[model samples]
Target: MLTQTVFRSEDLPVADRFDAWCEIMGRVYAPMKMTSEFAADFRAHLRCIPLGEVTVYPTTFQQTTFRRTPRLIRQSDPEAYHLSVLLDGEGGTAWDGHEAAYRPLDLHIVSTSLPHETWSGRLPATIVGVEIPRAALPLPCGRADRAIGRQMSGREGVGALLTQFLTHVAADVGSYRPDDAPRLGTVLTDLVAALFAHNLAAEPLLPPEAHRRTLLLRIQRFIHHSLTEGDLTPSRVAAAMHLSRSYLHRLFQQEGITVAGYIRRLRLEAARRDLADPAQHCIPIHAIAARWGYPRAADFTRAFRATYGMPPIEYRRDGVRRQPC
Candidate 1:
């Protein structure tokens, strides 16, 4: 487990901020020579978050250029790969005779073992990065290395999902605990591998856990969208998503319910909300039930009473009366 560390260059005197930043950067990433025309005007902040086995840095810096020289590579290399996602400004990374440009929502990787250069052109350049040990990726290093300095996008597909995930993690970091580290690390690995798999057209190479997670999220989203469709059922959902009925049931089994049961529960919950809403009072109880896919008022009332301990009309009057004002 890794505790979060924050560093802000604004906390230092203008004369000391640059050197202090270099010192911290050396430890967090790797030893490197950094040059920035805006160093005299330097202002930066970084969140060093450790997710069990990997470290992520949500960083912002003014115009800067960084180089990993051969001499610097041997000093204190972590032998890890840095996956950088540019959140602002334009940046470029070059290594092994290849160069890639990164704009907002673009991502690329850099290998600490190889000499490379990255530079920013705009004002404050904000980026989120994860440093992972080569062995943790489940991919051959050589194949992965080819992607170094090659710009990829974080705007759609798995890339978009990853960017959202990272941003969410950064925003919710305060709620995370030490015990959550290993699971968080696993999530990071799965997302990264899935991204690479999608990019390289190697979906079969993705970890089983990643595929399972992707399917579950997609299914839940579909359930939420189809809640009001009267004909929605496990068989129909499976057909729409191109999954076997048995497989869909097995997936929902992990959630302690059959797929059909899950859909029914969602429909019932929606019906209950409508029933309790004063604005919905003018609407007939049968209409509200049909609105949530419960065409039969008797069936809806039975389920509602079983769950909430009262009939729909009685519960609505009681609930509304209990409200002050």
Candidate 2:
């Protein structure tokens, strides 16, 4: 399922707003309450989408107050995990006789079964939440819960990577494809687990498979940042990351993909983005391709057709013709 809904504060009346929220919250939480004051003028600029097997709701709260507690001893679906990434403001949680604080970019994972209270203060705030099945997470539930409400800075290591991933996904919500949801979900799960593992000082607690997966993620990030450079090759990527080319190749092989193939796919993805842009409608297809590393027009066309099922010119023309009136 790939259903999405967008809500803007300016679109609804103050009196009817709380009812709207209840409809949305009911889909995720079993029992929750909304205050009248919290509902009126508690502006929410948000979107919710069902991405594959998971559901993601990205919300920006404007100076509001609310609290949520589980309605049952156990969640209706024990198999699911609720992960929250704090984008702004301050909040706190008290669960299992433990209290913790949260700041911007901090991720909190709470079991659906836990009885916890979360409060966002008077300041405006934004959060992106993902609901994933328990089987999807590679970490133990006990250790994972221990990370809730603890601050994790988005400037270093896996925290930075996870922050970037969430930021990008939220920014480009309309561009994602049905096929990209599951893979994106996996990345979200892995990054959350990596961040939790780093915080617990329990690197050894993670399975070996997770360690290798995280390593490849770091490598992929490096490649994505350096994609525009002509020198961004296997050798350059290896040297920049201080890994041997053979080792890099082996890592990709484990994932059943090749380094060169990955590079090509990234390049094609970038080109597709440009082709669909109305601002770039006047730019020649060859120029767009060259900007993404395909220097020759013929080569760019061949690669674009092979990857996208159509030539660059046709894709761009179709994209422009479909613009809203």
Candidate 3:
């Protein structure tokens, strides 16, 4: 059965909360006994549940002790990717001769089958965990394992998007419908893949078709946001995104055009829409041209004629004349 449980440390005595948490862990790692020596000062806010084929758990705690002591060996194969996001915490993990320290908004991925040890000192911490089948992720199996116990910061771009998505989901877990599980699972997979791709310097590893479509969508969004700026040139766009001007041009070339040509077409499209609107009939042609980044009326007129075989004034006049009563 699908189930969701929310717990607050203050709702129960500290000892009771600790015991309950251990029980939850037991269920999560069924047939494997789990134990913890929670600090007397421990406190937490947590939610756990099984949604469809995925298990989502979120925890916020302070001054906690965590250890899988006398580590019980699994009698069967354990295959799952445990993705964790540290919302607020100071901690580190030791495994396979590697150690990683984590701070706020950092993500960590670890495998359940791994022999690992983690410790969070006196600092308070919050984390969101997503447990999914290894097959759910679209990447080489060993790729994520390499990043395990390492910190992935959420300070910019795609990282920021993933961080925000996790934060929103954690804050509103109750509002999500059971039917949305598959879609949510896919989103989680995509976000994880994107993060790994960024980490590995292997953006090309992303399915080429999907990567191109995603890039185009991002470009379109960037262009739309800067439409009001007169100097929204390819160079400026490239610079804003830390891409080289030549690289930006190459991207536009994929669509069979140069960057400048694309910009011109988009501006002209906007100008055409404005001219066809009856509410803007009284606006001067030059004003419309300037609004769409044309600084000189003569230049705008020449370009409009070259593209549409007519000047802006005539186009607007003809368009209005063709309107039905």
Candidate 4:
């Protein structure tokens, strides 16, 4: 599991919880003034995951107002971009004379270098916040600043992918090893750079590696969504994504896999699960094969045998026999 630090207000004395939380906030972020009606007996939870220079915090807290004054910035500034993915509740942020309101699934950004204030409504909120160094992003300051204090959607395009990735990492930290943190952090940073570049219409400014990774993520998403279709081929995927067939092939090659092979692997994996599923036992093997893009039973059998060293029929029988009575 990825290493994580968790903080729960309930673990401390009722009167001390809020103050302790404020101390934590100062340690994790720049010092800020936090106020809430629930401060008397605040109930909140925080999980912090550090990925190298990037850190992810999934927090649940009561409605509170947070303000970072110019004095705080002068005292110390991380010079980082703070992104909040509002999983629940409504909130607003104001910075540098710009103000915007945000709802669930909306992406809100603020710079630690800029004095700002953010407040949630009467209800509690669940937020997945990410802190990325300003220098780590490839975009220029002027261009990237356009996104701060502006409302962005985390429901579509690269933003959606990023939101999903953050939530999955936060929720399934145990699925990852300790050494994976830095690599995971790198992926998070790359996605953030792509997201910011795309948001600012400055995709050309991204390094070749960042741009390629972004495109590869988009292609993979498209392929997974189109996996059930029989005509889901490299050419079709390229055309759908407005790229050439060769480029699509090259992208997959860079990942050390061929386009066709990747598609086949996904399909076979799907079929293998169905073949071993007790609920799907009555379904014909040919039908199951066709359902996952394989039209011919013989061809599916050959591919399945090559990949798993057994025919679909035998595999299903073995799975059934191994089941508890």
List lDDT for all candidates, in order. Answer: 0.80, 0.72, 0.69, 0.86
In candidate 3, position 324 carries an lDDT of 78
Segments in model 2 whose C-alpha atoms lie over 4 Å from true places: 1-3, 63-70, 73-79, 202-325
Worst ten in a row by lDDT for model 3 = 29-38
Q: How close is candidate 2 to the true structure, as a TM-score?
A: 0.55
Model 2, span 107-159: residue lDDT tens = 76666656765555446678888787766768887777767645556767887
Cα-lDDT of candidate 2: 0.72
* Index of the highest-TM-score prediction: 4
> Could you tell me the lDDT of residue 190 within candidate 2?
80
Clashing pairs in 3: none
Error of 1 at 212 (Å): 39
TM-score of each model, in listed order: 0.60, 0.55, 0.54, 0.62
Q: What is the model-wide C-alpha lDDT for candidate 1? A: 0.80
Off by over 4 Å in 4: 202-325
Compare candidates 2 and 4 on TM-score and give the better one: 4
The TM-score of predicted model 1 comes to 0.60
lDDT tens readout by residue for model 4, 131-221: 9988877778878777786546799998999999999999999999999999999999999888887787743243465457546755765
Candidate 2: give the clashing pairs: none
